[model samples]
Target: MYTEQGDPCKVLKLINSDIQSPQEGEVLVSMMAAPINPADINMIQGVYPVRPPLPAVAGNEGVGKVIAIGSGVQRLKTGDWVVPGHSGWGTWRTRALASESELIRVPSDVSMATLATMAVTTCTAFRMLKDFASLKEGDVVMQNGGNSGVGKALIQLAKHSGLQTVNVVRDRPDLDQLVTDLKSLGATHVISDAFLRSRDMKEFMKGLPAPKLACNCVGGKATADLLKYLADQGTMVTYGGMSKQPLFIPAGPLIFKDVNLRGFWMTKWNSIRSQEERQAMWDELCDLTRKGVLEAPKHRLVPLQNFEEAISKSMDSFTNEKQILSMGD
Candidate 1:
């Protein structure tokens, strides 16, 4: 399958692309499902760091069924459902070819779309909460872009881990409905960007524990304000810069309060980790998913023929959110 790369006519064209047979330590796969995350589009525009060859089959993560396995490969076999890493396995087609090391075999019962997105966002959320911050019960974390794929994953994971969340979103005419929806999904305090301007915010936070960490996806003053709300020894991890502006970290948070600022990119870590470690992390995430603690990010399925409209919709995730694309039901 081939895809176009431009603003007005971003067409993901399907053609008779040959499926290269698996070499030693490689596998041949038939695509079952794929999730069209925002970073996938950014790569096509040359804005994101991890670039596949141009005119690429454009998808980051997806579940595939092994049709054939190379001689040296022992872990995966023909007919097994496996999910490859987010960098190279574009799942916008009838079949996929990938390395045996890149595949994470999943159980037959789990949804294929769930397997697709669990790689990047869910793993990032787990690392942020457990490895990065060491969040404890009763402690608080705050973030913006609360409806994003990563943001929604964080909300579910945090709730499962016995933590409280304060989510920030843009003001809308249906603000009350939005807050209610977020609360249902584990948000304790859902407020608009305008709410950040209130001088009494510190007072509003007086009753709750000071935020131990702030996860910023929406940058600029919104990020800085989240910093101002953190406790004396808190940390902040930034993953996205949707605003396309420089992130302004406030001096006082660093100088007096000792807040640590850091950035996270899933592709870098996924590339560096060994196969055993990657599979372990994925297994842990799957356990949570099996227990119903995590849910697949909202999906908008589109047929391979309607790739243009699907690309436009997924690119607009900042306002209207969707994930997962495949041949329609």
Candidate 2:
């Protein structure tokens, strides 16, 4: 646990501790796996908007099996799999105790990685697509950071919903392979930011309709470029600022095109929505995972003891694959 806000590598250290038996309305879980997301890293550095009280646990999302339940617990039982109902549960540990209301039981058979990683990325993608715009089967959706966890989830979920996607990625040495992978995941078009700006880019969209919605994760110029492809009066939703740069959209889109800009934070959504509403969304996303339609992006399973190394890798701008902490049986 960390006592101060600083470099995650320097502040977080491995510690052994004991957890008491479940009290009333509580459940004890043996964590199976958890992902190291960008938000988790930002929270560690004290850069994220939401901060847990000092001496907080390190992770925000993961999947675990219920090993014990207090007398008052009714929704979950021993042997059930569950994800945290809210954020800042300190999920990085091998096991944890949570109130029954703070845990959502899910299918135990779903792939550990998909279930472990789904709570944040897939839920965020679903909400962005469902809430921001009224998209038809053939309507188009475009997004930057196309290879990110949320980006990949959006591609799969969009394809399942019959919406087309134009995905943008940074120029990488494996650009061709990355393009191929994204296409396989349901992206209608996969192009680098440079390619998106090329002369022939407009010509390439001749058949497909202009995108009605755009998901912006990487802000700054990347968002500006993505905005250019949005159809007139389209809505652009900003959920993250990976570029760590200010966003500047020309006044023309806001005034002339009548485009709309909005922002979404899952943390805030969870805080305000009814439990039934949140549970319904979770059930839908988890159902998709069960059916093999939605999958987590490429990830490496790292033992908890190697968390510092995993944190370092996740902080690298060039790292494309996600890192998940494995709580070995």
Candidate 3:
């Protein structure tokens, strides 16, 4: 828990606290694992849009097991595995008293890490694919930040939907290996930001359909590149701005190509969507996971006591592996 917002590694302190019995409509959950997400870091820094009260526990996503359920709790029972139905539930702790409505019970057979991380990245990818455009099999989709957790999900989910993907990542020292890895996850094409802007991109575009939809997580020039190649009347959805730079879109695309620009926030979607709608999406994603169509991104399992190390690794530049805090007994 942290008393004030600041650097997560410096501000977050571990402490023991008494676990309380569930009140009416509440359930006691034993948190199994939670991944260190970029949003979690931003929230601790007090920059994210959603700020829980200060002196708050620090996590927005994780999986837990229902250890006990209080009176009036009907949807979940002991031994049920669950993920937060909404964000900002403070998932860093080993145990929590959560209202039954705050958690969504999930299948117990899936791996703990996948269950912990899927609620955010996988769900975001699923929503974007379904909500933004009327894409068909063999239609093309493009996204920046292709190696990120959400980007990886986009590739796999798009592949499973019978659509092709053009994934863009920052140029790295081990670019060749990264390309191979993304392709192995079903990315149809993986290119660096530099490659996306180069003349050779025209030749590459000739082989694939112009993307009917482009997903932008990294804003600025990378996003603009996506717009340039978008099919006429296509849509571009902005979900994150990792570049910390405002979008500088050319007027031509909107004026001449009839391109559409939009934005999405998973947290906002969760708040506004009906429970049944949310459950349907979760059921579909869980089904895909069980069928081997969706795989967790590369990750390292660190015990909860080693949260400092995990946070440090997560903050490192260009770190690809997710750091999951394992809290299970």
TM-score of each: 0.92, 0.98, 0.98
Candidate 1's C-alpha runs over 4 A off are: 1-8, 317-320
Q: Write the per-residue lDDT of candidate 1 for residues 205-275, one digit (tens) a residue.
A: 88799999889988988888889889888888999988877898878889999988988888888888787
Query: Cα deviation of 305 in candidate 3 (Å)?
Result: 1.2
Backbone clash pairs for candidate 1 read none
Query: For candidate 2, lDDT tens digit of each residue in 1-329?
Result: 89898899999988899899999999999998999999998998999987999999988999999999888899999999999988888889898988998888888778999988888888999999999999999999999999999999999999999999999999988899999989998898898988888998888877789899999999998777877778899999999999999887988778778888999999999999998999899889888887878987899999999999998988887577899999897
lDDT of 3 by residue, 89-115 (tens): 899989999999988889988878888
lDDT of 2 at 81: 95
Give candidate 3's error at residue 258 in angstroms: 1.3
Computed on alpha carbons, the lDDT of every model, listed in order, comes to 0.78, 0.90, 0.92
Candidate 3 global Cα RMSD: 0.9
Q: Model 3's lDDT to the true fold?
A: 0.92
Instruction: List the candidate numbers ranked by TM-score, top first.
Output: 3, 2, 1
TM-score comparison, 1 vs 2, better candidate: 2
Q: Per-residue error at 149 for model 1, in Å?
A: 0.9
